[model samples]
Target: MKLKDSAIRPTAIAVQSPASTSTGTTAGTADRAADRTRSGVLLAALGVASFSLTFPATAWALEGLGPWSLVSCRMALGGLIAGICLLALRVRAPARRHWPALCAVAGGTCVGFPLLTTLALQTSTTSHAAVVVGLLPLTTAAYSSVRNRTRHSRTFWGAAVVGAAVVIAFAVQQSGGSPTGSDLYLFAALLVCAAGYAEGGQLAREMPGWQVIGWALVLCLPVAAVGAALALPAEPVHLTGHTIAGLLWLSAGSQFVGMWVWYRGMGAIGVARASQLQLAQPLLTLVWSVLLLGEHLTPAAPVAAVAVLVCIGVTQRARG
Candidate 1:
């Protein structure tokens, strides 16, 4: 009887094994793939919305606050929120060796980028800033290829040159009248911010995307805070309802939530695909500028948008 039972058990195991194993594996793989796709879509949407409002929010805040003050306050608030999240998640502290890379990204993205965009919006319309920012990917790709010692195709260079020409042409066309000192300051800010973005993207490849940005904001807080404090004495600081709301949106929506979603999307789908999603930002900015600031969408807006779209497509294909 015992020998008969053992033989029966072997046959039963064999009969059940293949069907259950295959079913479980297929279901698990499907679930994971679905999750990744969902996450990617959510992240991309969040990044687009958050980034679109960036210029409008900055423009609103700068109505009362100085550029440095607005930037400093936003960074400080964002850093605080990120710190809480890191603590809640029990994320491990980054290694010492990563400090330089982290600082570079923080200074560039959190401090440098926002600071410049704010200053730019002080004189330029959100539409103008959007146009300038649309060129960010091209700048980043150019920097990456150079830094990585990778030779880009002629097409990549051509697209970059053409896109740059569009930006320059727009600037020149806009510059026919007397440009203010503030406008020059804004252009300087755009250049610096672009450098920050290129540096941040490179670092993001090595470090956890969230942590890289999180730490960068943390590092930049002190610098921003100090600058804000110094600038406060000379500026007429007023905290109006519009300014407060603008600050809240920029800090919470754009810096904190937007960046986390962006980095997460970058992790799930590679940066190249995630970046194409940013193409929506400029057009959205144009819309928002019209609605929020009553600024007209210039005829050049459509042309600039097309140029940015073409550049984004070219860059994405090149990356692939």
Candidate 2:
């Protein structure tokens, strides 16, 4: 009886109480959530960095290729890269139910944004066009809220508005204080691209992030092929080292790989939070414009940069 009692006491001491287990579980959950947030922020930042160079790259490409040829070739090249990746990995096609969203991704990012923005780049300088694209965060957030039925805090909204104002101010100053025809194309690009981004963010939740962009790229191949076929013959191309390099970056970096991590980050965080990071994109673009495109850097640029950073910090902190 003494031996049996001693063994039972030891067994009881080895077991944890329900309260202790619950507390441990909760702590683990919090740690994981924090890790995810950090990862998402880093990933989103990379995507923004990649995207920041896009306007400059487009400018470089435009030195040789016509707007239609540039857009069509870039899309086709990007799609081919993505399709090869999918084939190599043996990734399955997304469910038929997912096609509509994929089409939106294809139509907006692959077709609309590229075409409009390329056309705008013909008339607008990269610096001017970039600040216009600065509104993307707000547009994307609004689209996500409406489409996904998620709401953000007032803090988030405030920061987004402030950031947008700073960008618009810079754009207005750069453009000589009036709207132009190119502004129309840029604004249209923003709306369509926002739609693509919002849909891609949601789709990332259901599949691997790379796969989402990969499939979207693949799905648009037919359209891109047709565009390239028609546009290449009609439009002119004068390929140079700068143009080739720019085209490669546009196809590989901006279209596929950057967006792959972007969607992943959006899935880790929320679309709204992830997008707030893009407020920095214009300032980054400003730097690229100065370095790569030899565009002038104005005194107001430094001030706007600081303000946008503060706004990004505030938006990131808000729970929404």
Candidate 3:
């Protein structure tokens, strides 16, 4: 009778096994999700660190290269590198439907932000450039929210307003209590970069992250090369080590390599959440300015950076 009972219970044991297996699978999926999110965050932070040096490096590079020459050459270099990467990796072109987004990416990042920011750095101190670039998180968050078709609470908007105000005040302080043309250029760069980031992040969801930027750079290659040719200075550049190093990094690091990580992170983590990580950029940029470019920072600059960071954090956490 005991043996017969054990044989009958085997059916129940089989039935329970499926439930246990299902539970294990669900837990495994959750763990994978958590791990992906963590990796995305770390990548975003790395990209931000790479980007923080851009303004300082540009300012340093500008000492030898004319603003137009610097922009044209760096972009051409970036385009060439990106084109080579695309060919090397055998990446397919984005479908025709994605061409519009790719064009927007090319216009905004490959053209607008780099051109505007380089010009802005010409007239602005690296410290001032850092302060202006601090506006990026707010702009990026706004654009990301729109691109993703999400809603933010009033708390988020309020925080953004306050953060913008703080940055504006800091810019004014840097310019003797009035906005300079450099401020306008930097602000334009911020808006254009936000658009590029949001568009590229969306595109990254469908394609490889690096490929999005790589393709866009390739798309702009001819234009960038022609522009560089047109903008060549009459006098040959007396290239210093700093100038050469800065241009190389700007071309390869900021424009291409950094965006690889950034778009990947944004696609994985969602653009709004990823953009929040940029709050740390201002502080990092300040450090770069002081160390790399020998720029002086006003006491207010640090205070404003902290205030903006806190404001961005609040906006990120605000409930809709």
Output the number of the lDDT-best candidate. Answer: 2
- Candidates, ranked, lDDT: 2, 3, 1
lDDT per model vs. reference:
0.70, 0.91, 0.82
| Tens digits of lDDT, candidate 3, 1-320 | 35676676745333568889999999999999889988887888888989988887887788788887888888889989998888888877779989898888888988899899888876778777776777787788888877778987888778877877787677678778777778888888989989998899888889988988888888888887787787775535768989999999999999999989999998888777677777667678888877887777778866877887798678657765
Error of 2 at 32 (Å): 0.7
Give the TM-scores of the predictions, in the order they appear. Answer: 0.77, 0.96, 0.89
lDDT of 2 at 169: 90
Top TM-score: which candidate number? 2
Count steric clashes of candidate 3.
Answer: 0
lDDT, candidate 1, 87-122, per-residue tens: 888888778977776776676668777876777677
Residue-wise C-alpha lDDT for candidate 2, range 209-275, written one tens digit per residue = 8888888888878888888888888877889999999999999999898989999999899899999
Query: Who is ahead in TM-score, 1 or 3?
Result: 3
Note the clash tally of each candidate.
1, 0, 0
Which regions in candidate 3 have their CA more than 4 angstroms from the true location? 1-12, 17-25, 233-236, 315-320
Q: Which stretches of candidate 2 lie over 4 Å from their true place?
A: 1-12
